[model samples]
Target: MMKFFSPDMKCSALVILMINSFCVFSQIPHKFLYVVGCFENGTTEVQYEYDAEEMLYMDFDRDEVVYTVPTFLVDDPSKLFENLHIYLDAKKAKRSCKAIVVLCKEEEEDPTEESDPPESIIYPSEEVELGVENSLICFVNHFYPPEIKVTWTRNGLPVSEGASLSRYYPNNDQTFHQLSTLTFTPREGDIYSCTVEHMALDRPQTRIWEPDFSHDSSVGPDVYCGVGLAVGLLGVAAGTFLIVKGHHGR
Candidate 1:
């Protein structure tokens, strides 16, 4: 029982089968790449859930597009957009459905404050004295590319002057580096802080230091805590003695 179909009919059946297969695969309409505008303090590229099915891409879409971004990522509370793809409807091949991964900026409540170590930075050992008598300058050094903007802030206010800044290439690390100096001044024992800012991030990385007038050299938290413990023990002993004397009198 060998019956041959007409050439026209055979061609029509093949075309229909191919259309059905396309609808099953590429036409399923699942999320591939997720794009986010900004993350926490120190993130270069916002990460998305790994999807083995589809290829991942940058902020931009399409099959082939590459972008260069700073190592550290964007800041918090940044205005962002969400993206996704939709496939052609199975029932209606002519119409393509748009599947939106709704702007979920507030969906899972975003995230808590990021608690990550800051970028690597080192200050020179030598301290530069400021003309403001008690003031001294400690610089923030950055060895990175893309030319990031540097700023000095005290108590969260923009600071100017009494700052030393420079950039150089010594063929040492084969990389460029920048140093931004800030004038740290405090009366007697007030705390002074140095903050380094990066354009790529929303918040600045900060380090705090307070001058100890009691010691000839600046004593930090460790030494101060020991002194506090000794004083606390003395107070407890004095209270115990007082309570004993009161009981004897009774």
Candidate 2:
């Protein structure tokens, strides 16, 4: 079991992130089952994994356990009986996670440990086309403590209309990663930026993006002109050949 407290928090009742694992060797292929939970901002997320693949997760929005692999029982006979209790266990885990967060209160601010600032990048989901709707993705990864903030700006102005943030996902290195997305139509001369704020950094990290259709959009016209010039030269050559042949015959 591994436990991670909310980074960047000094309050008495802070966020709790926990991951628990179980191994089964009854079959030829060994299997690993794990549960991960994060309690924060009056919300809880609990996920179940089998052999490093997600099997189920608690949906806080719908207040139900959603199965990532729908045919869980059909896929694994060993899990047929365990499947019945998995949902109940997830619910229990969620309750216990919340209780721990409430009970584990920090009387004073704990000293900040060495933190890892997130590496961030911003890019469009698809090739940018002027006047076409697209999404801008800001990916942040390899940050410790799992508490970070991401914000977006367009041409130096703050934007929030079509922006969304994803829940923190654990990486193999025990760090975390997250994504923020913004939807908008690409236009000429439009610049976008994604900024990340974390405790590890003295200053926020920012990544900028702008539509560069100069190369992609210009290929069509350039090809057309080149082809047209080649065809015109070929026509002139053919006409000269016919005229020379007529003069020679006369």
Candidate 3:
């Protein structure tokens, strides 16, 4: 046989059960939708609804729905706003009509694992020309955690002016890439180095760039060859003139 409790006892028991459930639920990591609103009569109502378990956002007015979406993946966006009429009616009966809803999700760490030292390349801009103001870019790719320190040095002295580091961006494989640029006038024999420091490295990695000397090296040979060719043409012209003059004299 089942026993039925009095109305007052049943109400007390229900309240106690709700409180106990709230305590247990609060301990577990879960996403929630928090709603708060005020009515014209100056009464306020606050509600907390768990993600995937409840969809009571309709308790607030549409204008009051002003919260960031939860970070947790939504498996069913179609059902996100479903069953609103029931909650709206319940909220109306409770006299909590105007409200704002905000979705909150627990923060989770990034799933990508930490990686070894990042690969780096230091190069001047493609438009680099001699005696022109240009920038050198230090490209650091395939790194994890997105925490790195980039520094620049010119001719063994630290360069602080006109140096900037770009925001870390994610690569296709979930790794990160960052760029540091140094803007300066490229002078002859200037040695620039880009140094990268990260937790993955026992020592900082550095890449060096110097002005290309191939053009300068070829200039001497080119000038010598041109001068030799001109001298040979002059000798041939003199020989032809002598041959013409001798034939005329004969």
Q: How badly does each model clash, as a count of residue pairs?
A: 4, 0, 0
Q: What tens digits encode model 2's per-residue C-alpha lDDT throughout 1-250?
A: 2233443333322433333444465544533444444343445555555455555666767766666565645575335446477556666766775666555443324533435688987767666678999888787877766679999999999999999997666665545677788999998898999999998889999999888777676655654454454334333222100000011111
Superior by lDDT: candidate 1 or candidate 3: 3
Position 232, candidate 2: lDDT: 49
Clash pairs, candidate 3, are none
- Cα lDDT computed for each candidate against the true fold: 0.31, 0.61, 0.51
Against the true structure, what is each candidate's TM-score? Answer: 0.30, 0.65, 0.42
Best by TM-score: 2
TM-score winner between candidates 2 and 3: 2
| Candidate 3 lDDT for residue 238 | 20
Candidate 2 lDDT = 0.61
| Tens digits of per-residue lDDT for model 3, 1-250 | 1112222111101110011123444677554434333322333333434532323323244424322234375655436546554455445634533221111111112222334468887776544468888888787876654568999999999998999997454353434567788998888899999999987788999999887645666555644554454334333222110000011111
In candidate 1, what are the lDDT values of residues 1-250, reduced to their tens digit? Answer: 1112222121101111110122326756333222221212212222222121112223323322222222254332122222332111221221111111122122223322211122423232223233234433333322222234555555556677776665321112212334455555544544445666555456767666554445334444554454454334333322110000011111
1 or 3: which has the higher TM-score? Answer: 3
Clashing pairs in 2: none
